[model samples]
Target: MGISKKTIRLYASAKAVITQYLYLPGSHRLNNVIKRIDKLGNSEVESGIEKVMRAFAGRHRNIEQTFLNHFSRIADQNKSSLEYFSLQKKILLGAFFTKEYSIEAAALFNPSIVPHPDQQGLKADEQRFIMSLRATGEGHISSIVFQTGIIDNMANITLDNSTGYFTPLKKRLDTSYNKLFISKRAATIPEFNRSILDNLPESFSAAEASHILNSIKPTEPSIIDSVMVFEKIMDNNYELESSSHVPLNEKVIFPISNAESMGMEDARFVKFHDGEQYCYYGTYTAYNGKHIQTHLIETTNFDVFKIRALYGAAVADKGMALFPEKVNGKYAMISRQGGEKINIMFSENLYFWKDFQILMEPRYPWEFLQVGNCGSPIKTTKGWLLLTHGVGAMRTYVISAILLDLHDPTRIVGRLDKPLIEADENEREGYVPNVVYTCGFMLHGNHLIIPYAVSDSATAFATIGLDEILRDMKL
Candidate 1:
């Protein structure tokens, strides 16, 4: 996933190589050799001179006095040798400890911290994918590369100096198999723009920002495979503006159906000029009344796809399976994709990884294989409610709802708090485990028809009044 080498030579310089050496068994002996060299530099010559002086001294008593006075300058030499040995020992110790610390610190990738099988499938969230690791406790996400293909490209390179030739990691786009994947527009994402120049000073000019932004690849790859655009039709709580099919237009429909008892409420919808008439299912909650339980609304993906791509309702692969387009229409379900149920408001199938090999990512915590379809949905005002489900990796599932624009659903016109109900802990821990899924839903008056699959095997459901959901899914 990086650049090539030869072009690196043509680009610029590489980071300097710093030698990080380890202390070996013979290091102490090496220290001894240095000690001998010190002796040769300071002691041998002085000793030889002292021998000559003693020989030259005349009588035995004079010789004794001369020996005492000369002393072979041994005092100074002895002190220097001791200091040298102390310094040398310190140096050797420093090297040994430094290497030892590095060895210990580098063990983070050892199997204990990361325990997952090697598999390829998307997780709950739709980004930063994880790949199957070389099990045996290595890590969850690690890969090796063997193929390289690219034409001319400029990149930073390293040099040997003597030869000005550059070596580069000329990483390039997938200009292979007739693919020239590229994004021509400058990145508009504030964080991305910020990340590009994050280290730059405030004085940096827009030109500099432009340079950094354009230097790297601009488009991030899309991971999920379906999309839907919901168009709402309500102006407020009235039906006056909803007859139109345009979503997020300058116009809006009114939420004409009002439930006065709910202290506060939220309802959202999506109505596009091109959309066919569709039903809206909401997950509702009632705060002031005794109807404390919450519920989900059911709707179809065909309406979702009318205005957007098929996979707009995305999850972090682990939370929800990709709404497969291969199945299309009714088949694009969370649990019962393409199947029919005798009842419109109950559930029978809950979805899961099934076998870790079904998707394009690995299962990990950050990428914990499954999460819920929590993004509020696109709906018409009457159909303008957003519904979401929350799933614990092993213990619980809650369904929540809110209301969006009758046409422009992003307005997030409404939201719900206090999830209606959470699944039972005992019911949530099987192999395929405690789960809740809603791919299809509908609305009939104040009732939200939600058929959900639980824990991977059986499907069941409960009901919440429309007024309950309208107030809770706020913001």
Candidate 2:
């Protein structure tokens, strides 16, 4: 009944391509490369610079500025040696150290949608929205990328065209850290030296923390864990800002910390509301090749982001979706700590979590393997409408829905008797086949708009009546 009553439309123009590239600096053999570049005579250097600019400048925005920025990454001693050279020669040297990396060459999927912060110029039924997706490039490294679009009254999605040039964000290390907070978060580490942390001032700078951590001369193997813990925590926290001239869609949040050295996967972004103030919060899994942890991200606008690691037992698994507002004066999160069932937790502190209650389990054949929330729950007059995904036999993934009481979300109200949506014949083939997934979705007017991944390779959209879904859910 559910499958026959609804029709899903796929946008043919909404797919990621391999042409977009980020201007990344290559640091391998830097000293040798600089020496070789210095050996070039004036005429050779000038001619080479001109040729490089002519062929490559058109492909990037502010190519010369990017080259200069890459040049600044070289050691001060190397910069002093190059001071005698002309500006053109220096720029050419920077170009030699830079390479282009396509941010989405492999796949772009798992998108979550939130209303755009600036919604000034829209018609009565037109809502502008921001969508974040996981862009996988070379090395299978995944990063968060954005797309802006508008949903009309008819429930059609029109994605903004790319500016043709994608640029990476400029990362700034957080200048300060709270010593007590750091110690508390790191307390779970077996060899963490709380004594050293106790001696530090209440507040400290990153340099101070590093100095203290480095000064420890380990007498045993366990002490090394203290240093490693400090370093990883320091690396996990940082701020990212986009170039003023870069469009939202062109700015990419690549991995900058050791905690997510491998990738940042499946960011579930929600427009969080507190009192009269509002900001965006996202929970994503940070993978450093060997281990995984949940990280919390905060931003008022899409241009700037503050990312930090989430601590405590409830965050041990991936797919932690924050509710739009606090539940009974505490922040609420839906998580899958055990990887088999959907669980819910509340926290007084946003960065830490300790307790959770089982919210749902695998009840049917389609979800006999596991179940998880597809994104943040959407508040409705009836209840909190949550989109979910279930894994059945052959690890097949299908998107479904459930309802929770508004005041006390821990109480289940209604659930879907069958899958809301699953992979179609055509949608079931890509990077990871037989899977349909989404990090988040949004409710517009009477329609629920779902932007889902097709086999983990590309993204597509689906729209169904909110009333139809509520009616189908079993109470």
Candidate 3:
């Protein structure tokens, strides 16, 4: 049996544009460029400052303040005393070193839906949702952006208009690491010395770890490897904050950690409950041009986030999604460690996972190449309804559904033999052709609300009856 696609009309939005600031790199070449601007005549400098502000002031919030911040960082080494007006001029000159980056200029796709934290203003049968999307910009660098919307009982979707201003978190919050976990991760590197971790407290800060690394003298040939590992560990664990004044849609979670300098791709967000309060957690892939790592993001109110690298053998690949709640009193996750088969993993700690059991494989011809979970499994009365993506001939990607035993999610109960959603004629054109992918989906009443990407270029929504999907599945 196959899932019947609904006939609802779909639309894409062009108004959800987020702007990011691209700062100039600190280098000898750039140093000379700034020096030449500093030597310009007063009249020239004033004229340049006015021109720059007139063009960019309307595009950003507090543009002058941002320029001043950048100037202070770049000119801190200057020993020359200057007047307030001169400093302002210098700040304006530094503004030339910055450019506004439209984060979603290239593509906006791979969306995940979660229930909004505050849902007080909605009508009956109307539920508020917070959708996280992968906003790809120049160079295909993806950052996490958001859209707030509502889904009515009839399965109609409406996305809120974007704030037009994008603000990356300016400051990182200091985070502490578990001494045991750090030591264990260090042992994985062949060049690392376990003794370096000795005598440290159970929990330590980044500075404390760096200080310990500095005390060691490296005479081994793998010294570079050891240093790289240390830096990677420090870079992967950090915190970020956005201003409260910024709208949720305006705030962007850009790549801050060195491990994810390339991009943060496909965030699968789930509203997790720990028997008391609900917290949102996302498992996303972090790419650094050459290598990929899995990272975990946690936030209670979506304003502040704590992103850290996932550790252990099972956290090695992309498409790792956590169960919305604990199973059998342990944290559960769905992962694809071998790149083809879906595996279920349980962990005592959220950041670390070492054990896994094979749950599903490519059983149908439509998924002969590979299969992965679309998002966290949605729990239903019948079972755990899991939306999955499958790759077939010509590298086409399609969405399908399966049911897993609620108590033991590893046991498959029912599955759809035919594709549920595939790339249509109009949707087959984009950055990457013939692909329909989604990091997550949400269930509203009797409808399955799917916000998916078309050929990796733009995002659109679809809806299907949950009962119809279940009835068509084969056990």
Best by lDDT: 2
**Candidate 2 weakest ten by summed lDDT:** 12-21
Name model 1 segments beyond 4 Å from true: 1-383, 392-395, 473-475
Give the per-residue lDDT digits (tens) of candidate 3, residues 83-111: 44486576665686566676777788899
Clashing pairs in 3: none
* Candidate 3 lDDT for residue 348: 87
Steric clashes per prediction: 110, 0, 0
Candidate 3: which stretches are off by over 4 Å?
1-28, 76-85, 171-173, 176-181, 184-191, 198-228
Overlapping backbone residue pairs in candidate 1 total: 110
How are the candidates ranked when ordered by lDDT, highest leading? 2, 3, 1
lDDT of 2 by residue, 1-475 (tens): 3333224332222233222222334544677777888899989988998898898787777888877766766535353556775677678877886776766777888999999998898888999999999988878888888899998998877888877666777676556678766877787566787666754677877778788768777777666777778777877877775455678987778887888988999999999999999999989999999999899888998877888898877778889999999989999999998899999999999998989999999999999999999999999999999999999998899999999999999989999989988998988888799999999999899989889998987788888889999998897
Task: Report lDDT (Cα) of residue 340, candidate 2.
Answer: 93
Q: How far is candidate 2 from the true structure (C-alpha RMSD, Å)?
A: 3.4
User: In candidate 3, residue 27 scores what lDDT?
Assistant: 65
- Evaluate model 3: give its TM-score: 0.90
Compared with the true structure, all predictions reach lDDT values of 0.27, 0.83, 0.81
